[model samples]
Target: MDSSTHKLYHEHDFDSRQFLENYFSDKPDMVFGDDSLTFLIENFRHVFTVGHINGDILIDLSIGSFVHHLYSACEFFKNIIVLKVNNRCIMELKRWVDDRTGAFYWGHTSTILQEKEENSDQFEDQNAKLRSAIQHIVKYDLEKENMTDPLVLPLADCVLSAWLLDVISKDQDDYIRYFRKFSRLLKPGGHVILIGVLNITYFTVGKDKFQGFPYDEDFVRKALAGEGFIIDYCKVQERTAVSDLIDYKAVIFIAAHKEK
Candidate 1:
């Protein structure tokens, strides 16, 4: 394993969290009163805030204070499960879920940053290079033998993976495959709520860097289609800057169900 890369990622995540906290503190309504959070609260009965939660599972592949917003919004559902592959992310999530009944899992990946930096060097070829890098990262990280397969979790009425897709894998195909695995983790007819970043670049947590996979409305729609999920309700909300330290455009929140 590339230890330096790993450390860099961890530091980036730390910095990102602080940045987001400050960013969100400036605009509470943009996050809490936003339609995306409203859609999630209204749709998913049982939410999993993948990385961390104040009360529910806030499983988003990226790092942001959004997890805090989830906690505040879903305080009624005190039972939350937060999972993260990154030790740093997991720790942050754990702290947020402190004393709450929640489960944590380790599943970290660094493909996004590698791809971003490599492509950043060549401005003209950045998009194509980033896309290619993403594909490679997804295939190797999520599809490799070392990664978890057939993620079996206790039956839940619904699952929520916020900001997860944009950072978990780079390749669209691999992203779809990972989503398929996520779908299988839920019981038949179960639903999933996904929140993603649109055209975001690198973010930081402390000194570590967490990479985001660029995505658009069409990409997200098509990805869900491939995973046997139909969009029940979808909306494109303005990107509430979670961090002034980094550059990101907007966030796309989606509510979909696994066809019975």
Candidate 2:
């Protein structure tokens, strides 16, 4: 992998604080990630409405620095463990979850999700619940034979990953292999929720660009099926805001269950 693609996400170039300010904050023009949060919350509500997703544990596989995507899942499951690729990302998450220093703002994301649901949620209470739902935040290394090796992470009843496979990978083959590795963390008949930026080759973190696997919906479907998952729900959200920060055409959300 090229240095620019891989190194951009390391401590030097990647800033969790800047990440939120650019993407997750309530800024009127935060076009980098608003659509993704909106799309994920909508699909999460629909899936939970028709089906039962509650279980003992749900693992979030390398969610980068984002936290609010799991807000809806917290309603169905009590325990949510988030895994990240580096200590920077993990510490960034803990700052928010543990209410420590240097925590980036998530009120915008929390409020938006709470409003979409039927229940009325106070901003403070909602954030508290979100913090409570996250049980642990650990660092994960995909280069290990098993990403959760040494720790022996419990096989989760559900796993959630967003744009992880695309960004961490060097190529399509590596992406599929990484996807399969993450799938092993799920129990039989477990659900895996995935979000991807379709046809994107790279996206910016600060000023540097990082690689994105250029894959379409069909590639994702075939990859998941090959990994023994059955796609149950799928939604594609087109780019609504025009921004030069990222060059992606659409956002995809898929909920798939492992074959028993």
- TM-score leader: 2
* Per-residue lDDT of model 1, residues 143-231, tens digit only: 44433334423444455666666666556775687677666546676667677667755554445556656667898899888778888
TM-score, model 2 to reference: 0.91
- Give candidate 1 misplaced runs (Cα > 4 Å): 1-66, 69-79, 99-152, 240-244
Question: In lDDT terms, how accurate is model 1?
Answer: 0.47
Position 90, candidate 2: lDDT: 76
Candidate 2 per-residue lDDT over residues 48-74, each given as its tens digit:
667677788999874468877877787
List the candidate 2 regions with Cα displacement exceeding 4 Å.
Answer: 1-13, 121-124
lDDT of 1 at 190: 65
Worst 10 residues of 1 by lDDT: 104-113
